[model samples]
Target: MASQAESETGRPRYVPLCSSLLPLSRLTLIVHGPEHGHRIISPVEGCRRLYIRVNGIVQGVGFRPFVYRIAVRTGLAGFVRNLGDAGVEIEVEGPAGDVKSFLSALRDEAPPLAEIAELRVEERPPTGEKEFRILASRDGGEGGGTIPPDIATCDRCLADIDDPKSRYCGYWATSCTDCGPRFTVIGALP
Candidate 1:
C-alpha cells in the first residue's frame, strides 16, 4: 500500500475536493493532465462550491464589481449576476474557509447603499473552474422585468470619478459591483 505522501505525489494523486456529504465535505477524483510531457491524474481533485443569492436592493448597484473584487481578493473562482427582481446571484468555488469569508464579506462590507435584506447560500461539488466572472442579467418574464430604483452613488466610485486620469472620471455613474442604480427609470427627470 502507498503511504499518504507517496500516494499524493503519484499520478492521479489525491487532493481534497468539496462535496455535498457535509458542509465542507472532501472528495477525490482522477485529474488527467500533463507533468513534464506526461499525463498525470490527481487523486485529490474535489473542492467545495457554493451558490448564493443576495436579495433586496442588490441589483443595479455595483454588485458585480464588488463581488469581483472579493473573488479576486479571496482567490476564488465563480460568477455573479443580477436578477430582474432586484436581486443578485453568486456562485463560488474554493477552500471552505475562503468561501465562508467571501459570504461574510458580502453581508458586512457590501456597498453603502446596498441593503441586503436576505442572503441565501447552498454548497455543492466543485466544477473545476479556472476563474470568476460576471454574467448578464437574467430575463424576468415580460416588460423587461421590474428594475429596482437607481441607488445613490458610492464613495469609492465617487473618489474614482474625481481622479482626472481615471477611466470613469467625471462620470456620473460610477459603480463597483457593490452599489449603484437599477430599474426605477422611465423618462428623463431634470
Candidate 2:
C-alpha cells in the first residue's frame, strides 16, 4: 500500500516511488494518482568522461605539465600524454561540473609557449579513475604536425643564469619548458 500524508489544504498526498530500481532510460516515468499527475522530479547526476585532443605546437612547450596542474587543481582524475608530433591527448573523468570546468581551463589557461591550433573533445564512459597523471608520449602515425620554433630565454631562466649561487649561472644553454630551443640543437646518435 502506498503511504498517504496530509497536504496543506487538507488533501491526501501519495508518496512518490523510488525510481532507482528502474532503468536509467525509464527514470522519467510518472506514477500518476487518481487525479492529476503533474509532479516532476530531477534525475540523478552521474559522472562524466572526456577525451580531448589538442593539436599544433603543444609538444615541448610545457603543455602536458600545464594540463596535469589544472587537473590536479580541479580535483579531476585522468591522464595526459603526448600524441607524437600531432599534439597531446587527455582523458579526464569526474563529476560533470568539474569535467566542464577542467575543459574550460585547459583552453583558457594554457601555457604561454603552447600554441593550440585545434581542440577536440569527445564524451566517453567514466572509468572511475582515482588519480590524474602524465603518460609517456605515443606515436600517432605519419604526417606529423608543425614542430615548435625556438623561443627566447624566459625571465626565470635569465634570473637563474644571473644568480651567482645558481647551478645554471652563466650557462649558455640554460632553459626550461616555457623558454627553450626545440629543433635548433644538434645531436649525434650514441
Candidate 3:
C-alpha cells in the first residue's frame, strides 16, 4: 500500500514503496492506495515538456514535495517525480538562472538526508503549462535501487513557515528537495 512520510513540521509526503516486487504490482498498489494524491489537471489542447534526472537518496524521502515548492518558487514549468532507483527526475522551464538556482539548491540545500550523487539536467521546448507539479511514479521496469530514510525540514522552508503571510507561512511541513522525510515508511510495508 502507498503511504506518506511527514516532515518535522507534519506536511504530507510522497513515500514510494520499494520496487523489488513486480512493476505492475507496485504500480497497482501505489495507485490504489488512499493517500496517493495526484496533481489535478484540466484538459488543455497543448503544453510543453522538459526532462531532468537527479540521482541520490531521493526516493521515499519528501523529494516530490520539495520539488513542488522549488518549481513554484523559481517560476518554473514542469513536473518532478521519484524514480524506482532512489533518484529524482524533473522537467522545468523558465529563465536559465531559475533552472540553475533550482539545481544548485538540490545539493547546497537538499533534504536532511538526501545525499545527492548526481544531477542530470536537459532543456527542451516548453509544454505550454502554466505551473509546475509533482507526478506519480511510473513503472519503468525492475527497480533494484536503495530507498533513503526520512528527513528533517530545511532551514529555508522553516523560515518561510515562521514568516506570516508568506505563501508557505504556517506550512509546518514545508519542504524542498533539500530537506524532508524519507525511508521510514518503506519498512512498514511488506
Candidate 4:
C-alpha cells in the first residue's frame, strides 16, 4: 500500500507484500501484464484460525450443523460447539478467501430457527488442523441466557400443521424439516 502522507511529503512509501521488508531502493517493481487485473496469488495462505463467538438463539437450532456444512463447503477446517450460555463458538482455518466466504454464509444463510444477535470474531495463529468437526458443548463464562421456554413453531411447521394432507397436520408433537422444536437443518442446507 502507498502511504498518502509520505507521498505528499516527497518519496512514496510502500508496505511489504509478504514479509522481510527490504529497502525500497533494493526491491524492484515489476508489472507482469496489464491484462492481469486480479490477484494471481494470495499474499498469505496456510493454517490460520478465526475464533467466532455467536450470541443469540443459536442453541438447539441446528446452528452447529449449519456451521459444519458451510465450513466443509468453503473448504475450511474448524470446530463448532454450543456454549452453556445459549451461544455458539466456531474456529475456522483455511485460505483467507474461503474463511471470508464462510463468514458471509454464516451471516446470510443461517437456519430458519437461528436468530443471531451478535457474532464476535477474533484472529489466532494457525493450528494446522486438517478436519472440520462439531464438538460437544461445554460451560461458558459467567451466567448466560436461559434456553427459551420453547422454541417458537416455525412458519414451515405451521404450514405443515395446517395442511390437511400433510402427516404432521394432526400430530401435535412433530419433527419435520423445519421443526424439531428446533430442526436438524441437514449437512448440505438448513
Q: TM-score of every model? A: 0.59, 0.73, 0.52, 0.62
Cα lDDT tens digits for candidate 1, 1-190: 1122334457644244434223322333333345434433243233568889777756555678999999989888889987766577899987778887888888888875567777788876677676889998875512223345665776788989999989999988687544564545544311
lDDT values of the candidates? 0.66, 0.75, 0.61, 0.68
Q: 1-190 in candidate 2: lDDT tens per residue?
A: 2336878977777653232233445544343555556555433234577899888878778889899999999888889998755578899977677788998898899888788888989997765577899998887533457666788999999999999999999998999988889777624211
Which stretch of 10 consecutive residues in model 2 shows the poorest summed lDDT? 15-24
Q: Which ranges in model 4 have alpha carbons more than 4 Å from their true place?
A: 1-47, 146-170, 180-190
Model 4 score (lDDT) = 0.68
Winner of 2 and 4 under lDDT: 2
Model 3: CA > 4 A from native: 1-50, 149-190
Model 3 residue 186 CA deviation (Å) reads 2.8
List per-candidate RMSD values in Å. 9.1, 8.1, 19.0, 10.5
Number of backbone collisions per candidate, in order? 23, 0, 17, 0
Give the C-alpha miss distance for residue 54 in model 3, angstroms: 1.1
Which structure is stronger by lDDT: 3 or 4?
A: 4
| Candidate 1 Cα outliers beyond 4 Å, as residue runs | 1-46, 141-190
How does model 4 score by TM-score? Answer: 0.62
Tens digits of per-residue lDDT for model 4 on 1-190? 2212354657534432321123324334332333443333323333357999998767766788899999999988779988776788899987677788999999999987678988899998756567899998887543455342345566777787889999788777765434554323323211
- Model 1, position 186: C-alpha lDDT score: 45
